[model samples]
Structures are given as structure tokens and as C-alpha cells.
Target chain A: MKAAWSAEWLKLRRSRVPWMTVLAISVGAAAGGLFMFISLHPGRAGDLGLLGAKAQLSTLEPSWPSFFGLLAQITAVGGVIIFGITVVWMFGREFADHTAKDLLALPTHRAAIVAAKFAAATVWCLLLAVYLTAAGLGIGLLLGIPGPLTVPVAAAGVGRIFVTAVLTIAITTLFGLAASVGRGYLPGVAVLFAVVFTAQIVAALGYGAWFPFSVPAMHAGLTGADGPSPVGYAAVGAMAFVAVTATIGWWQRADHTG
Target chain B: MAVVQVAGLVKHYGAVKAVDGASLTVAAGEIYALLGLNGAGKTTTIRTLLGMIRPTAGSVRLFGTPVTADARSLWGRVGYLVETPAAYPELTVTENLTLMARLKHLPAAAVGNVVEQLGLRPYAARRARELSLGNQQRLALAKALLGRPELLVLDEPANGLDPAGVTEIRQLLKTLAAQGTTILLSSHILAEVAKLATRIGIIHAGRMVTEIAAADLPHHVARALRVRCHDQDTAARILRQGGYQPLSNLDGMLSMTDERAVWHPDEVATLLVESGCPPVHLAVAEEDLETLFLRLTARGAGA
Candidate 1:
């Protein structure tokens, strides 16, 4: 298991996919900051160009608490797409690059390989979550927000943002399944887009609490005031369990034709 | 004892039977070559042997131990390169070998040693993405050769290599075999298989048509003596009178498959000369492996 993890880590470090994931999350963070800047002073929005005077910031609040909520929403919405791709690429490239066959029949078991990949994905997603919070806080400070980040307020806001990121990461495990069954990045990416779109529609229909993918964005208040119920968290746990089991089972049992 | 054993290995995908009751055994120190054409089930059989695919009904044992996907202990002594060689495109050659060494649980020194063994030192620091097809193949081979594994399973190990590279690889396999490492390789290139393998198994349409020692391959192929004389009719008559049945093909040359005639062609020449049909051209010819393979497959040996 250790060897497999190290091998997975080495490949992850050397590949451009990790860099791409970082870049995507960084852009999401910067975009979150941009939206906050625009909302704080809507009249000066013209200086920011196209999304300027025409865009409305009616429901948005120009305060630290609201900024953290915006960041959590970004992590929920953008985190799924970015982290989904990261996990998908981790598994999909083995097939795309035709390296999956080499991994089989090694001293290390296939289950260990699957576990190592999941571990790497988890680590990267957590790093992105940390970056999202840091970048959001930095941007809010730069904009000179009026609300004080009291200890209790900061803990509540950051904890909520972290949980949102975790939930988003949990559901993206399905992309790994898509990558394995579909055998490449394109199929997995297609699945990721489909899941994200369906989540939006499902959440809008007020069934977000029942759908795992919809719960993350809803928990982050992407669907307005209502947060996820305990049922939503249970659904997220079930999705994670199913995704990990299915991915590992596929790795062990499926014919690795590649 | 057989280092590798497979019996009645049948793998079916929906309506297509990719491998049907195929079986072979590679004893310790033997180089067994699974010879087949494209889509002839060579890769499928190799995959099953490596536990990449479960056989629909059959068994595979490596080193007298049953092989399963989770069987880790047996793999320590086994190294395999299936189908085309593959590596992490972003990692350098050395890094790739190092990773493989760790996966195989070999000493760290195995990395440099395998790189040197495969003549990959020049490209060690170069990323795999920059490598040519041939170098990528060498890197794959380097990964397989790490730790001087007791058994090597290679599929078209010579693919993408130049003539010199092929010879080098062939010599490397020979050296490994000489050191008592069992090798099971697959290739459609009969010449390479003939030169390297101690035994060859010909598979077609997902079944083993025949398995023969490499040295005995020529003997299994049909051999005959061809006689072209001033009067082909007279030569045929003389050969028939001499109790040897002669046959003619499109070229209108009388040929006899009589083992006696094939062994003692001088007797046939003398008989023809005595019958006043001095041969214009008389030569002993044997069917090549390609012709035998075509004949065997066409005959549906597996059917």
C-alpha cells in the first residue's frame, strides 16, 4: 500500500494535471474575489467592463460574512467541476495513456492502486479548499470589508465553507467511476457536466436535500436560505460509499482491455 | 516443474469467444512464445495469465501457485510487459524505473542497473513524452527487467525497435534465459520467436493449434523433393516405378513427399538418370513456418 501510494504520488507530482487543477481552483478563487468587488460597489461596476452597470447585486451583501458565503458557494459550484476533473484525470489517464495494463500483475494489488488514487484526489481537493478560503479572506481584506471577523463568526463561516468543499469533493467521486467505466477523460468530463447541470435543476425543484450532488451547493446556500438537512448529509455519505466501492470493484473485476 | 501453467483457459466477451480452451506450460528456464496474428487471442490469454482478466472458465498458475488479481506474493518474482509499452508521459525515464522498482519492491539500485541493462542511460533524465516509440519501448523493457525477476512475460517486446535494437533485445532475452529466467513472450514475428523461444505455441481463433519445441519446428513443416527433368512425365514414371508417389503443382514440377526420397535424394536422381530423364533441376524443398501456420489455421486445428 505504501509503495502504491508513493507511486501514485510520484505520478501526480510529475504530471501537468495537478498544475491544471491548481490553476482552475486559483481562477475560481480570483473569480470569487472579482464578484465580491463588483457587488461591494455596483455603481463603479462600469470600470470592470461588460458585467458592469447591467449586472445587479440586489441580494448580495458587502460584508465579510457575505463574502465567506460567496466563497463557500464558489467552492460548491466550481469545486465539483475542478475536483471532479482532477479525480477523473487521475483514473482516466491510465486508460487514455494505455498505462493501466502495466499496473496490473504487479506486486501491488489493484485495490491498493485504487486506494492510492483516491488518497491523492482527496489531498488535492483539500488543498484547493484551503486555497479557496485563503484567497477569499485575502480578497475580502483587500476590499476593506466593514464586518469584524470575530472568533466565533470566523469559525462558523470557515467551518461551513470547509464542509461545503468536503461535500462537493465527496460527490465528485462519481466522476472517477465514470472515468473507469467510460475509459477516458472525455467521458468522465461529460458525466461531470451532466451531474453539475442536473444538480442545479434538482436543487431548483426543491429536491436538493435528496440529491447528493445538489446538497453541497444547497448546504452552501446556493439555493437560497435553506441549508441541507441531515438527510442531505446521509445522501452524501451514501454517494461517497457507493462511488468508492464501485470504483474499486471495477478496478478489480473489469477486463482491463487496454 | 512448470514455472507457468495454464489449462483450458476460456474467456468469452458476449458473443465472441476471445480465448477458447487454450492451454500451455512453460517449465523453469524455458522461453515459451505464444505465436499468433492480430486479434487471435494472444493478448487476451496473456491478460488472463497476468490476472488482468478473469477467465470465464479455466485456470492459470504461476510458479505452482494459483494466480488471482489480489495475489501479490507470486508477482514479486514475475515481470511482464503486455501489449504496447506504456509509461507516465510526464515522468523522466529514470523516475519511471524508480517508481516501478518501488512497486516491485526492488532495491533502489535496481533503477540504475536496469537503465544500464536496457541501454537507457542516455535517455534516463529525459521525460517519457519526449521519447521516440523505440525509446519508450526500451523504457518499458527497463521497468520489466528491474530486479532480475525469475519470470518475464513480454508481448511483442521487439515492437517499435530498429534492427539493432531488436538484436540487442533478443540478446538480452537470451542472456536472461541463460541465467535460468523463464520467459513467456508473444509475437506474430515467427523469425524472432524461432530465434528466441525454446518452445512455440501457435494459437488461432482463440485456441492452441499446436505447441512444439523451437528446434523441432522445421521438422513439423512439410518437406519434399522436387524433380524437374527433360521429360517430366518420364521423371514421374520413374519416381512411381521406384515406389515413390510424385505430385505436381501449378508449376508442373513433379515433387515427392516420400520420406525415403526426401532423405536419399541421390537415389531419386540416379533412378531418373537410369530412366534416360536426367533431371534439369532437382532440389529438396521444405515448407516454411508461414505456410504451415496458414495450413494449420485454415484446417481449423482449434475447431
Candidate 2:
């Protein structure tokens, strides 16, 4: 198991897509910082208040922390998409390049390989999420947020984002596996999109919020003011369960051929 | 003891029998070539042996242990190159082999040595996709040999290769065999198989038609004598009437087989001369693996 994990890690390190995504996230986060600066400028704030002079301009104090939060949210989404794309690429490329035959020929257990890939993707997503969080916080401090940082609140927020990123990564990786081993990308992506969209609609219809697709939104504190539903936790657990089960089924039963 | 044993192995896809009652074995240090055309169940059989697919009906054993369960444990003792070389394209050649080494749990120190031995140092830093098809194959071979597995299963390992590349691979296989690697190579290339295989198993329509050792192959396939002459029809008629079985009439030349008949070059020349058909050439030709393959497959087709 350790060997499989190490092998997967090495492969990920050699790949350029991960680093490229990280770069994109950094750039997007920096741009968000610039946008916040322009929006919070004193001149801009005064001009915006002129049209409706009765509008409360005093409540419009844009703190550096707010900019940090906005950047963090954007970067977080970027990180999720990056991780999702990696999952899809890793799973789909093996079939596309006719390399699955060689992959399955390794002496390691098939289940171990699948688990290792998912673990590697999870670790990558977590690291990216942390980096984005830290970058946001660092930039926030530099731009003159309040002194004496609230480490506990920041840590809690980061932790939730990390969990959300992990759940999303797992779901995407499973979709990749299904796409890779089943047929090709379009079909696999189609199935993934359908499952997620349908789950969202079902949750909206009050069927139940405990679906895998709803976990990330809930974790990000975006689901209505119901305050972090337990459904998100359940969704995480359910996705992890289904991902493992589907991966095992794929490894054991699918024809390991190109 | 046989290094690999498969018995009554069967696998089906929907209604198609991909592998129907296929069974064969490779003994220690022997190179067994599984010969078949496309979709002849060669790949399916290899997959079954590798535990990539569960057999619908049958059993496989490595060494003396049953392989139904705990098949992964058995994989450490075996190496394989299935169809295409499956290394990660994004990884450097060395990285690809190193990853495989890590998977096999080889000692950290030994990984470099194997990579160097496979002559992979030149392309060590080059990503897999950057390497030529031959180098990609070499990387795949390097990975397969990482742990010095006792059994090696190679499926079309020489698919895309120039003559030199083929020779290099052939030498590598020979060296591995010299070190006691029991190899099971599947290919449609008879000449390549003839070069390395100690034993050959011909598969047709998911069934084993013949398992012939290298030494016995010639005897099993009948030898024919070619006689080129003018007035081919007259010579052929005489030969046929004189108890000779004509294999074919090749454009005014005659090819015939007669188990009990001996053709002294001078005697055949005299006979053809007397028959007003002076022979220009007379040569004995032994049947090769290709002919035997055709014959076997044709026989199976008729059945």
C-alpha cells in the first residue's frame, strides 16, 4: 500500500497539470486582490454614494479581511476545479493512451492502485486549498486587516474548506475511474454532471440534502441560513463510501485491457 | 514444477466466449509462445492468468498455490507487458521505471541498477511521450523486469519495432530466459516465436490446437519437394499416378509430397528428361511454423 502511494505521488509530481493549476489559482487570487483594492478605494466609495445621497455610506467600510475572504472563495473554487480536472485526466488518459493494460500488469493489487490514486488526488487538493487559504490570509494581513489575528476562526474556516475540497476530489476521481474504465470522457463526464445536477435538484425539492453533490456547497457555508446542515457530513460519508465501492468494483470486474 | 498452470479457464463477454476452455502451462525456464490471430483469446487467457479478470470457470495456480484468492500476492513473482506499454506519459522514463520498482517494493538501491542495466540512462529524464515507440517499449520492459520476476507474461511485446529493436528485445528475452525467467509470450509473428520459444501453443477460436516443442515442430509438419520443369501437367500427372501427393502446381512448377518416395536429384532429372520434361530445378523444402499454423487453423476451421 505504501509503495503504491509513493508511486502515485511520484507520477503526480512529474505531471505539469497540477503545478499549472496552482499557478492559475495564484494568479486568479492576486487579481481578486486587485479588484478588491479598486472597489474599496475612498474615491470610488464616495462616487458610488452620490447617486442616492440618502444611502448609508458609513456602513460601506471595506476592510482588508473582506477582500481576503473574497479572494479565498474565488481561489477555493479554482482549486476545486483544478483538482476535478486532474482527477478526470488521470482516470481518462490511461484509456485514451491505451496504457491501462500496462498499469494493471503491475504486481500491486488493483484496489491498492485505485486507492493510491484517490489518496494522491485528495492530498493534492488539500494542499492547494491550504495554499489558497494561507495566501488569502497572508495578503489580508499585509493589507492592514486588524491586528492580533484570530487563528481559531481562520483555522475552522480553512478546515471546512479542506473537507469540502476532499469530498469534491473524491467524487470527481470516481467519475474519472468510471469514465476511464467504462468508455471515454464525454460519457463519464456526462454521468458525473447528471448525478450532481440531479442530486442538487432533488435536495432543492426537499427530498433530502444528504446527497454527495450538496456537500461542497454546504461546507462552503453557501446553503441557506440553516447553518451548516448535517446533510453535508452525510454527503461526504456517502461519497467516500460510493467511491471506494465503485473503484473496487471497477478494479475487480472491469476488463483490464486497453 | 510448472511455474504457471491454468486449467479449463473460461471467460465470456455477454454471449461471446472470449476464452473457451483454454488451458496450458509454462514450466520453469521455458519460453512458451501462445500463437493466435486477433480476437483468438490470447489476450483474454493472459489476462486471466494475471488475475486481471476472474475466470467464469476454471482454476489457475502459480507454483503450488491456488490463485483464486490472494492473487495479488502471487503477482510479485510475475512480471508482465500487456498489449501496449502502460507507463505514465507525463513521467520521465526513469520515473516510470522507478514508480514500478516502488510498486514491486524493491530495495531502494536496486532501482537505479535495473534502470541502468536496461540501458535506460540516456532517456532517463525524458518524459515517456517524448521517447520513441521503441524506447517506450524499453521502459515497459524495464518495469516488467524490476523485481526479476520468476514468470514473465508478454503480450505483443514486439508490436512496433524496427529490425534492430526486435533484435534487441529478442536478446533481452534470451538473457532473461538464461536467468530462469519462465516467459509466456503471445504473438501472431511466427518467425519471432520460432526464435525464442522452447514450446509453442497454437490457439484458434479460444481452443488450444497443438502444443509442439521446437525440436518436434518439423516432424509434425510434412516435408515437400519442389520440382520445376517444362510440361508441368505431364510431370505432375506422372508423379500423381506414381503415388506422389501433389501439394500444389505453382505456375508450371510442381510441389509434391510422398512419405515413402525418395528423389535422388539425378534420378528425377532422368525421369523428367525421359518424360520430355527436363527439370530446371529440384529442391526439398521442410514445412515451417507458418505452414503448420495455417494447417492447424484450417483443420480447426473445418471442424
Candidate 3:
């Protein structure tokens, strides 16, 4: 497992996609800063035109908590796409590049290789979460949000953002399984879009708390309809367990002739 | 000692039988080649031997250990390259080898050794996408060579190599086998396989049609003695009376495929000379491996 982890991390470190995800999350945080600016001065929104129209879509306040909420919301929503790509790239590249056969018939167990991919993804996604929070803090300080940015406040924000990131990352793993079963980038991306669309429909139908895919967005108060109940988080955990296990089992047992 | 033992291996995908009852035993230090046409189940058989696909029936074992078992350690001594050469296009040649070495639990130094072994040292720092098709193949071979595996399974190992590169790979496999490494490679280049393989197993339409030893290949090849004469009808009857089954060939010549006739063309000449139908031309024509392979595979296809 350690050897697999070393190899997986080396691959992730050299890849451009991980860094691209960071930039994506950073851009999301910067956009959050813009939303906060419009919330502080609503009249300036009209003068800003399209940027203002985009800012007005987010109902934020000039406060640390509102800024944190905005960042979490972006992660909950954008993380599904960005982090899903991270997981998808990790598993799908093997097939897309036709290198999966090499990993099989190796001294290292296939499950170890899968686990190593998940571990590397977890670490990178966690860093993306932390970076998003820090970027939010920097953007807020430069814009001068209303609340004082104390160490405790910052800690609390980090905790909340990390929790949201974790929930989002958990479900992103389903895309990894999809990529494995589908054997390429496009299928995994298709499943991701389906999950995202289904989550929205399920959440809109007022059962968001029960669907695991909708839990993270609800937890982040994407609609301010309601925060997810504890059951929703548990459901997310169950779904994550299933995805990870099924993926490992698929790697171990599935016919890999192609 | 047998290094690879595959018995009654069968793999079926829905209605299509990719491989059926294919069996072979490869002894240690033997360069065995699996010869086949397109879609002859060569790849499927190789994948089953590597445990990438579970057989619908039969068994495959390496070093007396069942390949079907969850024997992770069993692969520590085995190395294989199936199908086309693939690599992480983003990673350099050295990095790609290091990644595989790590997965195999090999020492870091193994990377450099294989790079040198495969003549990839000059391209060590180049990204895989930047290398030519032949160099990419070299990198794949380098990865397979990592850990000094005792058994090597390669499918079309010379796919992208030049003529010189093909010769180099042939010599490398010969040297590797000479040092006690068992190699099982599949190739369509009949001439190359004739030069490299100690034994050849021809698979056609998911069946093992025949297995032939390199030394005995000449005997398997069809040889016919041909005779041309002015009085062809008289010569044919004379050869028939002389205890030879003679048949007329398309190019105005009488030919006999009997082993005795081929072995003693002198007797056929002497008989024709005494029978007033002396031969103008009498020479033995032999089929090459390509033609023999085609005939054998065509026979297997019917079966």
C-alpha cells in the first residue's frame, strides 16, 4: 500500500489537472469576493453590468460568515465538477492511456492501487479546500468585510469549509467508480452530470435531505431551503462506502481484457 | 522444469468464443512464440494467462502456482507486455519506469538498469509522448524488464520497431533466454519468429491448431519433388508404375509429395530415364513458414 501510494502521489504531483483544480477553486473564491462586494453596495451592481448581474444572483452580506457560506456553497457546487475530474482523471487515465493492464498482474494488490488513488485524491482535495478558504480570507480582508477576522473565526470557517469539501469529495468518489466501470473520462463525466442534475431535481422536490448526492449542497444551504439532517450525512457516508468498495471489487474481479 | 502451464483454457464472451481449450507448457529458458492471425484469440489467451480475465473453464499456472488464485506474490517473478505499448504521456521515461518499479517493489536502481538495458538511457529524461513509436516500445520493455522477472510474456513485442530494432530485440530475448529467463512472445512476423522461437504455438479462431518445435519446422514444411518432360502423360504413368504417387502440377510439371520421393529424387530421375520419359527438370520445392502458417490457420478456422 505504501509503495502504491508513493507511485500514485508521484503521478498526481506531476499532473496538471490537480493544479488546475486549485486554480478553479481559487477562482471560485475570488468570485465569492465579488459577490460579497455587491452585497455590501447593491447600487454599484447596476454599474458593473454582467459581473453585477452574476453577483446579484448570490444573496450575501458584507460579513465573515456570509463570505464563508459563499465559499462553502461554491465548493459544494463546483467541487462536484472540479474534484470529480480529479478522481476521474486518476482512475480513467489508466484506461484512456491503455496502461491499466500494467497495474494488474503486479506484486502490489489491485485494491492497494485503488486505495492509493483515493488517498492521493483525498489529500489533494483537502488542500484545495484549505486553499479555497485561505483565498476567501484574503479576498475578504482586501475588500474589508464587516466582521472581524479573528483566529477563532478563521478556524471555524476552515472547519466548515473542510466539512463541506469532505462531503463533496465523498460523493466525487462515485465518479471514480463510474470512470472505472465505464473505462474512460467521458462516461465518468456523464455520470457526474447525471448525478448533479438528479441532485438538483431531488432537492427541488423537497427530499434533498434523503438523497446522498444532494446532501452536500443542502448542507451548504445552496437554496437556504434547509440544512441537511444528520441522516443526510449518514446517507452520504453509506454511498461513499459503497462506491469505494464496488470500485475496488471491480478492479479485483472484473474482466480487464481491454 | 515447466515455467508456464496452461491447460484447457476457455474464455467466452456472450456468443463469441475468444479462446477455447487452448493449452501449452513452456519450459524454463525456452523462447515460446504464440503465432496467430487477427482475432485468433492470441490476446485473450495471453490475458487469461496473466489473470486479467477469468477463464470460463480450464487453468493457468506459473511456477506451479495457479494464476487464478489471489496470489499477489506470484507476479513478483513474472513480467508481461500485452498488446500495444502504453505509457503516461506526461511522465518522462525514467519516471514511468520508476512508477512501475515501485509497484513491483523493486529497488530504485532497477529503473536505471532497465533504462540502460533497453537502450533508453539517452531518452531517459524525454516525456513518453515525445518519444517515437519505437522508443515508446523500448520504454514499455524497460518497465517489463524491471525487477528482473524470470518469466516474460510479450504480445507483438516488435510492433513499432525498425528492422534493426527488431533484430536487437530478438538478440535481447535470445540472451535473456540463454540466462534462464522463460519468454512467451506473440508475433505475426513469421520470419522473425522462425529466427527467435524455440517452439511455436499457432492459435487460430480460439483454438490451438498445432505446436511445432523450431528444429522440427523443416519437417513440418511441405516439400514436393517436381519433374518436367516432353511426354508428360507417359512420364506420369511411368512414375506411377515406379511406385510413386505422381500428380500433375499447374505449370506443366509432374510433382510428388511423398517423403521417399523427396528424399530420393535420384531414383525418380533414374526411373524416368529408363522409361523413355527422361525428366528435363527435377527439383524439390519447399513451402516457407508463412505459407505453412496460412494453411495451418485455414485448417484451424474450419475446425
TM-scores, all models, native as reference: 0.97, 0.87, 0.97
Per-model C-alpha lDDT, please?
Answer: 0.88, 0.72, 0.90
Which is superior by TM-score, 2 or 3?
Answer: 3
lDDT tens digits, residue span B123-185, model 3: 999999999999999999988889889999999999999999989999999999999999999
- The sequence of per-residue lDDT tens digits that candidate 2 reaches over residues A1-258 is 888889778777777867887897688667655545444564664566532455433432355434444544463355445766667666666677776665564557767877777788778777777777777767666655543457765666566656656666756765766666665566566666675677568658755346666555544544433433576567567776887778767866776655
CA lDDT for candidate 1: 0.88
The regions of model 1 sitting more than 4 angstroms off are A47-54, B301-303
lDDT at position A258, candidate 1: 79
How displaced is residue A201 in candidate 3, in Å?
0.7
DockQ of each: 0.82, 0.51, 0.80
Q: Give the alpha carbon lDDT tens digit for every residue of B1-303 in model 1.
A: 999999999999999999999999999999999998888899999988888899999899999999888888888889989988899999999998988898888889999898989999899999999999999999989988889999999999999999999999999999999999999999997877999999999899999988889998888889889889878887787888889999986799988898999999999889888888899898999898788877767665536
DockQ, candidate 3, comes to: 0.80
Best by DockQ: 1
lDDT of 2 by residue, B1-303 (tens): 898898998888889988888889889999999999888899988887876778889887788677642466787888888877766888788777777777777776656876776788888899888988888887887877777889999989887777888888888898989988899999997778888899989888888877889777767777667887666778777767656765556465577666543345455666667767777778877777677788887775566
Candidate 3 local lDDT, A100-181, one digit each (tens):
9999999999999999999999899988888888788888888889877888887776777888899999999999999999
Instruction: State what share of the real interface contacts each candidate retains.
Output: 0.82, 0.60, 0.85
